[model samples]
Target chain A: MNFNFINLQPYSNPQYFIYLMIALIPIILGLYFGHRFKTYEAIFSIVFLFLIFDGSHWQQGVNLLIWLVYEFILTFAYQYYRHHGKNKTWVFSLAVILAIIPLAAVKYLTAFPDNSIGFVIGFLGISYVTFKTVQVIMEMRDGAIKKVDPVTYARFLLFFPTISSGPIDRYRRFKKDYEKVPTRDAYITDLQYAVRYLFQGFLYKFVIGWFFGTYWLPKITASALVVGNANGGLKLSWWVLAYMYCYSMYLFFDFAGYSLFAVSISYFMGIHTPMNFNKPFISKNIKDFWNRWHMTLSFWFRDYIYMRFSFFAMKKKLFKNRIRLSQVSYFLLFLIQGFWHGLTWYYIVYGIFHASAICINDMWLRFKGKHKKQIPSNKFTEWFAIFLTFNVVCFSFLIFSGFLSQLWFGWK
Target chain B: MDTKQGVLDILNDLTGEDLSDQMDENIFDNGLMDSMASVQMLLSLQEKFDIDVPVSEFKRAEWDTPNKIVAKVESLENE
Candidate 1:
């Protein structure tokens, strides 16, 4: 333990990957030989976690440690409560609310003054880890999670690769992979996918995203600001449009690149954690885009929030019409997701925009279903749908990027 | 010609995707059906069988296939 401690964000740079890939060599070999070296994996998890959570950012690590212990206890307690099979709905609800307190507190702190003490408890990946804990609680309520092995549960939560940003893995899917060693041939296929994803990730995040976010986006934003200044007040122009698209692309490539790395590293460790994006830009509609983009997060929302809420509403007969019920569900889902991003106007608006877009998309789908013959199905129309959806999503991303705040009101 | 076939017939009519051939499929993941379809199908199933399938208690895998759906109905009936 005489090694000099250095901290790095997981998959933040190309050099970090070099170190990680080298470290994973033994684990990979063990997996290839039909065994998962659990002790080594745990040791590395701690070491790598230290690498990320130590140094100047040790606050985050400490906070993460505390939060992990807290959530771990909460899930186990919830599981224990449910063990008697005498679970009340209110108990599960209370557990979920308690589980989310840290994230809610963290998000709320961002609304305070700079020197506010509420900021101290905040940590990187708090939201993601909260999602993981919350899902486990939900699945436990459903009897989907029968057993709670603390060690395996810890592995799922602190899974180093995706502990930061996520292509959120479900407990069942992740546990299945963790519990079994992939056959050599199957692992080779995973390795091939891992390598491909790595190459694609490097190009997307390091190259293209870097080019857009670091190099081009600022230039365009500057140009937009200049145009606004000349126009005698804050007003948008073509340069702002350029910023919109560039920022959108940057968001995609960078985050999707991160997701690819997370999945790639998971594959290297014999877990096929799911993919996050699947050519989202080609989506013909808002719903399709959500299905394809940040898929795990979207699906998480779909299963845990949207569907559950909608069903609850339906049973209560809250909305007379199905469309109204769906619209309200979309609003609640996106609004919560928006607030989750950060406590800001732009983020809130971004969520509302998507919510509204999906409601309209639902209407359009209904209309299209009713008038199948009236609307022509052809290459032109297909491309038009893709083009329209792409622009709409990019515009939403522009708002989500909080650039509009900078444009309309001087960025605080 | 039981509750299973009854569920399948409604699923075949309601789900826009082709579920006739894929009885043992993960109906949701295969992109064959979406949440709306699931909601509609669940409603239909509840009405047809007069069973209480709570959304919270329902796991996707348990009712992912036709056989699983049948098993679920049978379990509920037994209960």
Candidate 2:
């Protein structure tokens, strides 16, 4: 029940050192026999390490290991069936269903208050990993990729750099670059970038985000905006809103830093990972923002879910009969995407709000074309659109962080 | 309207410009429709026909001509 900062202390017991040692054992062995073993063997070593170091206790380790094994087996089977040019839709779908069960069970069932099942079902990276795994399998089924070697496949799924948090690499794109060896200069450059990213991430997380979360937010919410102050009065509430902006920036930097670190390490190991962040804040519209921000994750959603849903919906007779069917499909895609974030009411609302925004934008553009003279063509109109879009995005983030309750109930 | 004429009507609705009687697939390269306009066209196709037309489907080869889009739409409809 304690949402206090210290209550969420990271698990850093000395016994974790033993888990760390166990994890390193395979990496050592893999290096020793380098070319003698296959990609699967290397991957197994990495996955085993992930499993061993994933938790503090043996049961937790075992649970994580079981999930890893399930993912590996499913990935391998999907690859096998796909290579043989067999109809594996049923099999692939079953795997996706299985992969999502753990996430759904943990998020929905164990998240209840007074539930002792919290320890039994850890959700943290499960949703991310499950989504990535299903996408890899689906991509293979779509013939977007050839059969991935077991080792590379395993590494793709269990790459230590991205396993804990992800930029969610696509199997096909990642595999193409994985096979190429990077030059020494590339490694040096990647390392430099990685270090810079790490520093930025730390600054964002500890100095900026944590500062706002720990100190500034409470003060402003409690006092700053309450009194009817004059025009010259210091409105600390604006300061708090500014910190919210900083927090958003920090979150992106922190995650992107982690991604860069992973990518740099992968580069040293001769893999070229895709860039994740692309000046998302500067995006002129929500749709453009989605395209630029957390790019790999958004693209994963676009390729695997949005496109697939649209493809299937187009085949339906109802879709042929009504334009509403396309709108409904888009709405559903966003809803599922929101649910994928977590089984939270706020996330669902966030998704619906954005989906509706995009839908409205499309409709407006359509209507404006019919009455072209009313449309503005000046820089002011463009800036206004950008300003409105940014506020909409920030408001969406407010809902995402569960701050709407504070606004509505006067509860900080 | 006949099938080809129906396709032409849809294309005219989308581009907001009438196609020449001698319209060729080279219209895309002739700057008749830019990238943003093409995306708009795709969105309209998706909304109107209930087809999931991915941007990938509109590669230079396929989207260069109106005939290609009509053919693609008919095939998708058949599927």
Q: Give me the TM-scores of chain B across the candidates.
A: 0.79, 0.76
Summarize candidate 2's per-residue lDDT along A1-412 as a digit string, tens digits. 2222221111122343245345444433443334223354465445444443544434444666677787787778777777777855577688678767777776676446655554556534566678777777676665655666776666677665566567687676577656654455654565566556645645655566556655666664454335313223343356447545644655665566556555544443445566677777766677767777777787776656665666555444446533465467558778987887766678899889888987786576568768879777688887887887777777777667655444444432
Candidate 1 displacement at residue A101 in angstroms: 0.8
DockQ for each numbered candidate? 0.36, 0.10
Model number with the top lDDT: 1
Question: For all the candidates, what are their Cα RMSDs to the real structure?
Answer: 3.2, 7.9
> Which whole-number lDDT from 0 to 100 does residue B30 have in model 1?
51
Of all native A–B interface contacts, model 2 reproduces a fraction of 0.00
TM-score of each: 0.92, 0.71
Top model number, TM-score: 1
Write model 1 residue lDDT over A217-319, tens digit each, in one string: 8889899888976885558788888988999999999989889899888889989988999999999889889989999999899989988888777767888
TM-score of chain A of 1: 0.97
What's the TM-score of chain A alone for every prediction? 0.97, 0.77
> lDDT value for candidate 1?
0.85
Scored against the native two-chain complex, candidate 1 gets a DockQ of 0.36
